[model samples]
Target: MILRSLFLSTVAAMAPLMAPVSSFAAEPQLKVELSPSSPKQGESMTVIIDPPGNLPPSDASQLTVSFTKSGAALAENYPAFPLDAEGDRYRAIIPTSPLDSHGRTLLQVSDTIETRNLAVWVQKRNFPTQRITLRGSGSGGATQYELDRVAVFKDLVTPIKYWNGIFRAPNSGRVSTIFGVRRYYNGVFANDYYHRGIDYAAGYGSPVVAPAAGKIALIDYEKNGFRVHGNTVGIDHGQGVVSILMHLNSIPTTLKEGDLVQAGQQVGTVGSTGASTGPHLHWGLYVHSVAIDPVPWRNQSVD
Candidate 1:
């Protein structure tokens, strides 16, 4: 009960921070564009908006973005903000769901009075399922999961820094499990269970690198059962973009949180340290705290 209460209070405090800005003038001229033309389930895409430059420099309007189909919201993510002077288009990401339809997606981008809808066609991608007993303590894992969930929600929403281009692969190894597959664990069947990241199979001590320039947000090497990740590190790349490297075989003793790391810098090495079947790097990416497919980010540079 105490934990639940604390969670609710935390959410309440976040409410005001997430409230949409309602101070836009009527009928502001804005246009939205979806890049790649076609995307896939769990893939990352962009939604660019041409903001009106007639407004004063300080007249910042809230650009709200959501991916929905038949009235169900599949994802919500941030794009780069502040329509540049002279009316350049601003970019935001549209991260798709693991279970989204192969075709016919509706993207809603709006400010206050103006709402625009873009029809998107997403290609199909298959995600495999695995049913395994969690090798970590259920209680401790649950606690850390709750804490990380809230912390990620709060941190990823604010993309305070901007780095141009798409992210690179943390490692060149092959993926053991694709993102967004159904996960059936320990006799519990839940429709929402999906692998949030890609697992790269590697030998013990294989190097793991940062995919983009960002500040290290977290480094956990604690031995308590709660450290189910076992030497995990989080990087915040600004613009509400964040990525995490988990289950490292080894973490550098000199590394610390808040250190700025460039793209492709070494963070740790592949390991089977945490509840894993073998040595591998589990890398996950998020926008506004929502998990998205990292494949597209690896393939192309998103503006």
Candidate 2:
């Protein structure tokens, strides 16, 4: 109760700071709204920023939006862009990390002339883990790129919140492969390439749920040699947070781009569709564009 009160106070204080850009002044009026306003700490939220009026296209590049939790430094890729076009009405999918705890999140929207800000309180939720296997193929020489991606993610960001909400066990079994574990394919050393996501060892046909609320951004199933993230579903949680669910048996044909979803919603099922050794779910989280550890946020406490 105390935490909730403090959260509310912080949001109230931030409201006035987010003023509309006055017409007399040459600034875009900024307004922000969080879909499903109250969300669990590890869950995801869509941040929509609306510009006051039509402005010349020449100044469009000057507009910017950002989000940050009180004590943590904002990630470089924050205020991420959608897979589609870019314009005055900017949208980003923001995911709250487990480390976020109880605090106010500030969303700043600005143009060349003026800036506006909004504050939001993130609630807490319960997340549990289920075991599953992840299988994928990679080019013989791509080991370096894969490993570096993992290293950079772990070193840069602190895993404090579960931006993708709670993950359900993809299958009823043990984790065949843990996150951050070193791997060696065939007889070569996969140095620096710690696994970036968790692999639950589940049989085929296991249900895969949306880690959090988001819009379906991209779906790819082409055969690209050594580029192992096969048959993937990428969900954009506003404010630059994205969830990638890989190696699916089949993506629901009904699912299409720009589809809004809720936590625990079914998106796909586990399968050995692409570059795979077995059937499982390769779940990953990205802040803005930077990949981060998904485990910490999986089962975390807000207070």
Candidate 3:
């Protein structure tokens, strides 16, 4: 007992002589940059985060982000993934809606230690209204079966990025109806309805090509009860960017799901297979399952 007490007293005497360990180290600062500081409605914006050398532990599992518009919360705890194999660059994409109000949008990015808020200005955009009367528009609205089938492909997000640079027109034709157009069917105002895709008035049996590189994710036919979205082809361009071609007359017998396709590759032919008055192709581009305008994508390249 006496020896133990002597050892304890010796350690206590030496405790004050040892260098103090810091319990409160400064938090690491992350570099956050947005591709377009000001984006218009129906456009996609990317958020990039670069951490310091010593930050983000070896695991670096999940870096999360959230968005708020005019004090209204949108997505919460949305994931941001490493852009490269080395885990240095992290990125996430946010898609703006045509109905979104213009103002400053706030993005909250967080890690284990700290959180940061990024400000982005959203520009105003206007969409025109179109009045149309269909002679035979099927059973009217989309059936539950058709909706369920299309939803699966629209929500798909492949980890790989298959596209680069600007996207091309799926078919050579004049745009009959641009995206985000409010529509009136038979003089009845379509409530909560806006054209989700651009209508290309291409000739019957015209070749329909892929706008960008991707993998064929879905192929549905009109004969299979896809009455609303007949002869549809969906392409997953990775990282939440997807392309959907609807009302195709024919798709090559050899091309199936999981096949890698190059930009401008022929996928099908235009037709009036579903919910259409005449021969036309509807091309819709979605980001994170939200339909956005393809004009910006065609005009500028998003890194």
By TM-score, the best candidate is: 3
Query: By the lDDT metric, which is better: model 2 or model 3?
Result: 3
lDDT of 2 at 9: 64
lDDT sort, best first: 3, 1, 2
Between candidates 2 and 3, name the one with more favorable TM-score: 3
lDDT digits (tens) for residues 1-303 of candidate 2: 899667666666557555554533544356556653555555556666565664443444566767677565872223423222334455555666544555666766676656776666666543343333435753433344434543333233221222344544433446766654545555454544545566777788788878777777766663442246666777775444567777888788899877887777888888886567898888877765444456555665111
What are the Cα lDDT values of the candidates? 0.70, 0.59, 0.79
Q: List the residue pairs that clash in candidate 1.
A: 79-92, 159-239, 159-240
Candidate 2 TM-score, true structure as reference: 0.47
Show where candidate 2 strays beyond 4 Å. Answer: 1-173, 184-192, 223-227, 301-303
Instruction: Tell me the tens digit of each residue's lDDT in model 1 across 144-205.
Output: 66367437633664535555577887888888887786877786765776788888998998
Measure candidate 1: CA RMSD.
10.7
**Clash counts for the predictions, in order:** 3, 30, 0
Model 1: residue 19 alpha-carbon error in angstroms: 25
Q: Say which candidate scores most in lDDT.
A: 3
